[model samples]
Target chain A: MRIRCPLCGDRDSREFTCMGHETYMHRPAGEGWGPAWDSYLHLRDNPAGVTRDLWYHGAGCTAWLLVERDTTTHDILRVELASDAKRGNA
Target chain B: MVKLVEKTPAEGLLPLEINGISLTELVPAAITSLMPFDGQEAAASALLSSLLGMECPHPNRSTGRDGARAVWVGRGQIFVVGKAVDASVARHAALTDQSDAWAVFSLQGHGVEDVLARLTPLDLNRAVFKRGHAARSLLGHMSAVILRTGENTFEIMVFRSMARTAVHELETAMRAVAARDALR
Candidate 1:
């Protein structure tokens, strides 16, 4: 499957590495240690169907992307720059 | 202290010509990375225009005449090629000298796209990928920046450490393409 990078156009999937989920944007900050940190660091849910995940465009633009894809069908629903998604622009 | 002499990344390994294809190292005066701070895109672009004498390139597009150009490397980042960037460019953007960080080469000849097509996934057809178009993609297993500098000429940039690997890959592809042509 090809992933369309927001900045680099549609590129082969081999150029990207999937980094599990998009929860990387929700790091437990300032408050420090607690169960929240534990959950953020260790716990994860392997959900099927449409899911949001983080992908690094390592070979192409080197941009972090938030990819919304169907885990079952492997159809990419959307691809946005993680920075833009964090800024509510995606 | 001993005198230090500068050597190019592909020193003694390039200027190779096989059949009609040639691969040669390009030693530019400087290659600086230009990255605009958040919300400073317009400001940085305006400054870069006067300093580099060219418009700041858009994503996947390069701008400027020969000997001086800006090739977009990634989102919010551009590589200023063939010219020593002006100091004022830093006021609106972050400037980092990448002169020695990359191995730059010029690959030229007939069926040059055919040579690259075997290495990269990029569509190298001349009809769509014209002069000034650029792409950040893989050349074999190595990440590379490929730029179209002319109709039959292309500029390939990879990390300095991968100079030998890059040359080897391109040379193999060049010879294979040349051999294929010989069969026709």
Candidate 2:
């Protein structure tokens, strides 16, 4: 698989390491051992359709990317810098 | 106490020639990593441009003459080579000395592109990755920054610790390409 990095252009999947879902980026704050924290740490939805996930470009630009891909067809729908996604700019 | 001496990353491992391809270690005067602060991109670029006497580099591009150049590393990042960066630019960006952190080599020959093709996946056709274009990609199993300095020359940089591995990989590729070309 090839991922087109927003900063480095297209690169092979060997350069990237998948880091689970995009929600893994958001951590619950002001927590003192609660279900919200537990779910955030352990819960994951294995949807078969479209899903957004985070990938680290460890070998190339080292930029974190939020990739929207379809699990059924393995088609990449969209890719943006994770920082831009976090800032709600992408 | 005993005194310690300074040695470059690829001090004795390079300056190798296999067939027509030659790999020579390049010890630039200085190498500084520059990253502009938010909202200071233009200011930082202007300062660096004036200092290097070249336009500020854009993403995936480098600018300047030999002995003084800037190679874009990634988004908002560049490495100033060959000259000591001016302190005046510090107000616009963060500068970190990387002269000792990387091993740089100049690979030149008629079939330089064929040697790199065995390592990186990026398209390196002359028309596409023309001179002054830069890219951070994999060279064998090691991460590397590759720049096209001339039609038949390329500058490749890898982590200082991977100097041996980088040289070994390049040598292997050079010999393979040379042998293949001889057959043709």
Candidate 3:
């Protein structure tokens, strides 16, 4: 697998670490405290198809990435900086 | 101001010649980590250009002028190496003292890329990965900054605490390549 880091360009997968789902983008800091906290802390969805998730470029650029990838086929559809995506959405 | 006595992290392994390649410790006269303050790209660019007398290369690339070189080492960060007249370049950017944070070494010879390919996930093929290229990658579990300083030379920087291990891993890879070459 390969990821094109915004800063580092295309790099091998070993340079990165899968963080978790992108749903973590919605924080419990808002009014959805209890259930969101439980879901953030405990519950995890194990879907077998394409999903948007977070990844940390631990060994490369050290950027947080939102990766849209297929869980079953292991094909990456897209990647973008989480910070940029958040800002764009806002 | 008083200055601490400088020591290269891999100084003890100076001139580590193996398999026709020489792994030598490097002590760049001035090594600094420069990061732009948030939303200060224009300001940072101006100051760095004035200080470096050259354009700051984008990430994954390196640029040099007047003996000073800058390599993008991380997101929004660059590691400047080589000698400079003034040390006050920090006045322009968010500076972190990296003179002690990393151990710098230069591996030079014909098979240098072969040795690095064993550790770097980034392809070291000469066709694409040539001089003025920089990358952050893992070298045997240690996060490293790899820079192609010349046609036959690569400068590697690993965290100071892991300098010894980094040297060992590099040497082991060099030896392995040599052994394989001998059998051929």
The prediction achieving the highest DockQ against the true structure is 3
TM-score of each model, in listed order: 0.94, 0.95, 0.90
Stretches of candidate 1 exceeding 4 Å from the true structure: none
DockQ winner, 2 or 3: 3
DockQ of each: 0.80, 0.71, 0.88
Give a tens-digit lDDT track for model 3, residues B1-184: 9988856687667678887899988777777788877777667767677866755678788888424888889888887777542445555568766777788888999979899989888888878888888888888899999988888999898999998999899989999999999999
**What is the per-candidate TM-score for chain B?**
0.96, 0.96, 0.88
Clashes of 1: 0
What is residue B35's positional error in candidate 2, in angstroms? 0.9
lDDT for B59 in candidate 1 is 92
Model 1, residue A73: C-alpha shift (Å)? 1.4
Is model 1 an incorrect, acceptable, medium or high docking prediction?
A: high
Per-residue CA lDDT of model 2 for B152-175, tens digit only, reads 999999999999999999999999
Error of 1 at B67 (Å): 0.6
TM-score, predicted candidate 2 vs. hidden true structure: 0.95
> What is candidate 1's CA lDDT for residue B73?
89
DockQ of 1: 0.80
Candidates arranged by DockQ, highest first = 3, 1, 2
Model 1 agreement with the true structure over A13-49: per-residue lDDT tens digits: 9899998788778887777699988888888888889
TM-score of the second chain in candidate 3:
0.88
